[model samples]
Target: MNETQRREQLKKIIEESEPISTGVALRYQGETKRVCVYRIPLDFLVYNKYNGRISSRVKAYERLNHELNSENDEDRELIEKLLWESKVERNRKTMEDLVENGQMRHGIVTADGVIIDGNRRASLLNRAYRERDKHKWSPVDVDKCRYFNAIILPQDAGPRDIQQLETTYQMGEDDKLDYNPIEKYLKVRDLTDVGFDIDEIAKMMNESTADIKKWQRTLVLMDEYLETLGYEDMYPMLDRVEDQFLSLSKGLKDWQDRSVLAKANWEYSDADIDDLKVIAFDYIRYEQEGKEFRRICKPGKEGSIFQDRLIWESFRDTHFETMDAIAEESVDEEIAHAHADIDVVDVLRARDSKWKSEISDSFKNNLKYSVRRLDDRMEDAKPKEILKKVRDLLKEIDTEQDSFLNDEGVATLVSEINRMTYRLKRELGQ
Candidate 1:
């Protein structure tokens, strides 16, 4: 058949075949014979998009042929040699050797093509074909090879189908594919199977975990940074930028100020930053797309420490105020009790001597208003009830006031209250 006729016939045959079908044909290249075959869709052709340059079917053939012709002496000696024997053997060998040795190569195919399903023998054949230069090789030998087989699939296979098939193939093999390298290299940290326990994967790659953690924190601040520059989508480009940051920050490890890192113009020039901002904004337009105020405040560890200390002091002062309120309430109740008991004179004497002497200036000032109110209440109450109220107020003061005061202050307050209580009791003959 003419070349055009042959192509037409191949297409027709492919159309007529079932969803997953196979066929074998011969094609003559000048005086050479070529084994042309249709493989079922069940076969897979794995190719790395970043690296593979060959067309899909051709790449698949090359990969398969390379495997068949592998020079590893041990692979050449498998005894079972069943239909799937080579594939099973290869998987075992790959698991035991390639995986542990980390010699496996990864690549993606840009096109869809026929692939051998877990057939190591077929892979070996394909590998051999790949090793032979197309211009120098004869197809007659391939046609003569009875062990070669192919499974064909429809051209319009869905991605889901391909993924399902790939997963099946992976499961059939004993060797586990190590996706960690790509994942780790892309992100400095990855959460383990367990929740919250983030594994510092970059550390496994000989990177510093602390630095990686710092970078992760930086990532959290990326949105803010991007906002400051009117940028967006800083996530996808994180890997590249992080590397740049690492290089820039390497010498500045001792610098606790993040501003130093932020100010340091490493790989990104002012112009580049503008350009990157535009690119990021375009890429991540879905998120809030502008510079944020916080992004400009790139504080380092020291800055964070300073901020924390300020907050702590503020909280301490607030707590002290709350404690003062509690103490004043207690003192008021005590004064009112003394007034009702008709022991106002005694109470006044005790308060001037004991309360004034024991409590600090701050505590005394807070108690002043409440003490005045209690003294007023004591004037209108019966003497006996006033005394009881005074005792009760003193006990409440001892319990609640102690919590607000410092340890030494509390001890002094308690001692004074005890002395007053004793003196009052002796005077009342109770």
Candidate 2:
């Protein structure tokens, strides 16, 4: 049927059927009755916006009250008031558009009157109704705002169905509000619990299977890892750890082919996994200490040394026991800044006081690595490119020579530059 016919059909059904009874008289307990459009009272509808879409219900009610109490409680002005006062400003434009055009589309609400979609619109309409009795409007249409049009789902639309539907409606569309990673993780988990596989859920939800699998695996790892750290209740913290956890997951997966890391069914063993979890937490702290410290950990790379299997293996082999001790103690301390070096084992092992000073010492290694990389790039460059780079390097060297106060270091760098200059001139025939 066409849009007008469909809306008229739903309205006819509502007109013919009795309004859903509340309390014990309501025959349907869950969302298991029948699909019917209802002209639900604005006051009866419950406001439950999630995933940072709207303000808290209490705040929303207050904002609604504030607008209603105003002298000019016009429909158009109130809509703007709610949109302007919304905690999530992203909803404002959509809400403004709806207000300008009026609600042409219907919202999906539960039999118990909880809005599943079009919350911003519903909330505004409710606000208009609440204000109708209290204030006078220049262009009044309070009767039109007294009730909201909704496709009330069956009472038997259980939690899983509601979650799936809500996610489908809100997050499945390209223009809809993007679910926070943690929120998406929880939704994917719910879908999985309801017997939907990765591919099935992806297709149903209009998401990629790869993303579904990634979220599932990362969520499992996060839950287990948090439980191991005795912080299972801190799941909210996982929101900030998305990048870290994903990188850690990728890092661990890199070990899938290795016999040692693959022992526990292609995953780390119980004990080893615990070790890795603790290490991951510690790595998070070190990462928070800022780039100055990160350079000390991985020298030139952006990620932690723990992410590198070759370097991590040596550190793990040399001080596995110390790592466990540090992990245990660090968790208790809630450490937010730890040593950044893979050789953190050595420092912890020796109880080295000089390690703090080694923060600046790491710059030498970073410089060496940077120079080696430059050498490799220059080797790959054309003669003209090489000549230009050589000239730039000579100027940069002269400018930076005074930066290092260590006479020995400066002299050594100068000697290397002299050699490079001689070799470059010979190669370029300059």
Worst 10 residues of 1 by lDDT: 47-56
Candidates' TM-scores? Answer: 0.21, 0.51
Off by over 4 Å in 2: 1-38, 48-87, 94-99, 127-146, 225-235, 256-274, 285-310, 313-430
TM-score of predicted model 1?
Answer: 0.21
Model 2 TM-score, all chains together: 0.51
* Model 1 lDDT tens row, 231-334: 23223223224433332233223223333544332332344333333322322322211222112112332221112323323333443564355322233354
CA deviation > 4 Å runs, candidate 1: 1-124, 130-150, 171-173, 177-430
Clashing pairs in 2: 30-155, 30-156, 31-154, 31-155, 31-156, 31-157, 32-155, 32-156, 297-340
Deviation (Å) of 288 in candidate 1: 38
For all the candidates, what are their Cα RMSDs to the real structure?
Answer: 27.8, 13.2
lDDT of 2 by residue, 1-430 (tens): 3334434444455568665432212213323444445566555555443422422222233431342322233533444444445435654454444434556666677656667766667766655555544555323455556567777766477876676667666667674444445666666776788776787678656889998888888778777766664444344445455776766665555443343232122233445544555555544523333442332232233433433444444434533444333313343233224454322223232322232233323333443444444334434667677667667766765444555655777779888988987897898799
Which prediction has the highest TM-score against the true structure?
2
